[model samples]
Target: MNSNYSAQEKNFATALLHNLWKYLLLAASIVATVKIIFFGFDIDE
Candidate 1:
């Protein structure tokens, strides 16, 4: 039972980390887009 619980917890942690990275990247892209649109910041520059 203990081992099973540990495995489940590990899986949950992995999923949470994955989701965090996904959202972080999404937010970064949105911010970059907004900057480009309003401030004329070049992404390549």
Candidate 2:
């Protein structure tokens, strides 16, 4: 029973990390877009 609970907790932690990464990527993309809009598309660096 303890092992089962531990497995569930691990699953939850993995899922949480996955979701956090998803949101981080989304936020990064949004920031990049905003920067492009503000600075123009001259990202030729």
Candidate 3:
């Protein structure tokens, strides 16, 4: 029950996983910047 992925399928799956990681990193950075701008706009202390 664990032998159904061919070489092409494996490559595609690996590429998809890598692409997901890249997008997640980009999203995280964007969210962090937005949060800081909204909550820490006044840094006098």
Candidate No. with top TM-score: 2
- The residue pairs that clash in candidate 3, if any, are none
Candidate 3, position 11, lDDT: 88
**By TM-score, is 2 or 3 better?**
2
Which RMSD values do the candidates have, in order?
4.5, 4.0, 3.3
Mark the 10 consecutive residues where model 1 has the least summed lDDT.
Answer: 36-45
The superposed Cα distance between candidate 1 and the true structure at residue 13, in angstroms, equals 0.5
lDDT of each: 0.91, 0.92, 0.87
- Over 21-40, each residue of candidate 3 has an lDDT whose tens digit, in order, gives 99999999999999888777
Against the true structure, candidate 3 has what lDDT?
0.87
lDDT of 2: 0.92
Question: How do all models score by TM-score?
Answer: 0.76, 0.78, 0.74
TM-score ranking, high to low: 2, 1, 3
User: Backbone collision count in every prediction?
Assistant: 0, 0, 0
Q: After superposition, how far is residue 12 of candidate 1 from its true place, in Å?
A: 0.5
What does candidate 1 score in Cα RMSD to the true structure?
A: 4.5
**Model 3 stretches astray by more than 4 angstroms:** 1-5, 42-45
Alpha-carbon shift of residue 45 in model 1 (angstroms): 19
